[model samples]
Target: MTRKILLLSVSAGAGHVRAAEAIRASAALSGEALEVRHLDVMDYVPAGFRKLYADTYLKLVAKLPALWGYLYQSSHEAKPDSTTEKIRRSVERLSTRPLRKEIAAFAPDAIVCTHFLPAEMLDRMLRQGDLACPVWVQVTDFDLHRMWVHEHMRGYFAANEEVAFRMRAAGIPATNIHVTGIPIMPVFGEMLERQICAAEYGLDPARTTVLLMGGGAGMGSLDTVAQSLLQIGGDFQLIVLAGRNVAALEALQTLAAQHPGRLVALGFTDKVERLMSCADLVITKPGGLSTSECLAKGLPMILNAPIPGQEERNADYLLEQGVALKACDAVTLEYRVRLLLENPAKLADMRNKARALGRPDAGKQVLKTVLGQ
Candidate 1:
């Protein structure tokens, strides 16, 4: 019999959606008798509510980071039945009526939630006896937020043993937690040829290459960082990926023209694995998905200004693992890059640590666990 699986995510951040996509791709490659459907919970909600659910988060993180950080901390500390949490949960339940309807219509054999919103809703349903199938949750970040904890989940997939430990501390049973690492696209597991990837990107395979990414929306100070990197004295090149940020792409292109063959600017390409193949180091925001991809590629990283909440925690874990360095500004970024450039052994050590921590088959492991295969 073909079992149906529903993969749910909320797109307040790209990492959640991408994690769901990775699991779906894994299901396809598993060759099991399975049917999988991935959905963004926002798509089923009303436009007004959808904007509030997704846009409000983006605005908070991008504009009022301090306030966002405060809220993140406060929410985590707040009791589950606190008035504020109760009101927020009520609003979410009322707004996600359409999503509930969709879930009922699908009637999946099992459900996997990559983001907390759907998982929270599903938890309520299971507790109320409105949902019959088992639901699993995947924590996309290294840190375990309070929002991800629920009493009714069949299992929880964690990015590391530390995250699993956190889950167990949160009162989850030991058997229900699995340290599967974060799910990234299977392509990151492949060992692409560096020379081929470099040729495709018109980069020198012999030169020290640094790849820069600003998350999926390109929400960082890429221009300033690129300029700072250019000032460093080194025999290296830069590949800047301005994801879905056209203005940033154009700005990078203009700057690339100033230093032809030394800098390459691109916008939202799916071939990030190939770029990683040709690079010695990555300068990027420490989003869970991007960091997981870098780890899978065994690429060392200089993490830039991470968003104040989960991203900050992600940076902390990478630094502790000796896989990355965190930079606060353009000056610091330049210094970190220069320090790594001047110390080949240090850079190599970081790369080795990254490879040791990499779970390239995490997606496959997720599938196997969920399917009991």
Candidate 2:
């Protein structure tokens, strides 16, 4: 009999959702044995609670960024038995009931959760002896957070060797932690011909193409990066993704008007893989999903100022792996980007390093766990 496989994920920043989609696509491809679905589980949470949580997150990270940084640092310093963890557990107790109800209603043979919320809910239900099937949690961040670890999970799919190591340090059984890189949609992992893709995108084959990304929310220092890149005068074209920030997109549109064909501004796009494939160098903030996507494309990364917490750790991991370079300031970023553009050897080295670090088969392997194989 074909098993119903439901991939559960929240839509906080598009990372978890991206992973879930990737998993669903692969699970669907294994013939008649798997019927797969991907859903935004947060939609089941009370609308008010969801909005408040998302809004507060945006406000804290955008308006009071230092406070957000402080909290992120504090989480690192927090012991397993911290006060925050106590309150977190209490909230988990209350919030998991709806999730439990949904799982019972759906009655899926296996459940794959990409975010901590669904993982916690499944863990809680299983601990209470109410779970009905196998549950696997795919950790999106390169650094594993305590929120991602809970008793009763069947397995954990991790992004890298470091994340697997961190999961073991967090006391998860090493045998249960699978080192699959962050699951990205198959497009990022596709064997696209780079020269053809670049030409189709109206980009130059002989020159370096740099992809400048704001994060999922399209949030970053775009104007500064754009200005800096333009100042460097490299034989390159810049493709900047402004995401959903209308104001940010409009601002870049205005600036691109001054630079002519050197800059191309895009709003929220489904063509990320297309852009990534065409680019030789990518400059962006170090969000885990974006980093993973760049790694999949085998493009060298020049990291701008990374947000605290997971993104900072991702930047450090990639830098340590020789897959990426970090720019301390905009001027330094421009200088490094220009120098790399001028030298094909350094670019080739980084490209090779990035490709070697990526697990292109991660999405495929994660779906195997989804099938209980």
Task: List the candidates' TM-scores in order.
Answer: 0.99, 0.93
Q: What tens digits encode model 1's per-residue C-alpha lDDT throughout 122-160?
A: 999999999999999999999999999999999999999
lDDT of each: 0.93, 0.81
What TM-score number comes out for model 1?
0.99
Query: Against the true structure, whose lDDT is highest?
Result: 1
Number of clashes found in candidate 2 = 0
Q: Per-residue lDDT for 1-373 in model 2, tens only? A: 8788888998877788988888877766656577777778667767766775566777776677678778877765677588877786676556556766767887898888998878877776788888768899999888877778887888999888888988899889998999888888777888887788777667776666889998778876687778778877656788899898898888888999998878888899988888888789998888777888888889999988776777778888998988888986877887888778888898999999999887766789988766656
Candidate 2 lDDT trough over 10 residues, lowest sum: 88-97
Query: In candidate 1, what residue range of length 10 has the lowest lDDT sum?
Result: 219-228
Cand. 1 Cα-lDDT: 0.93
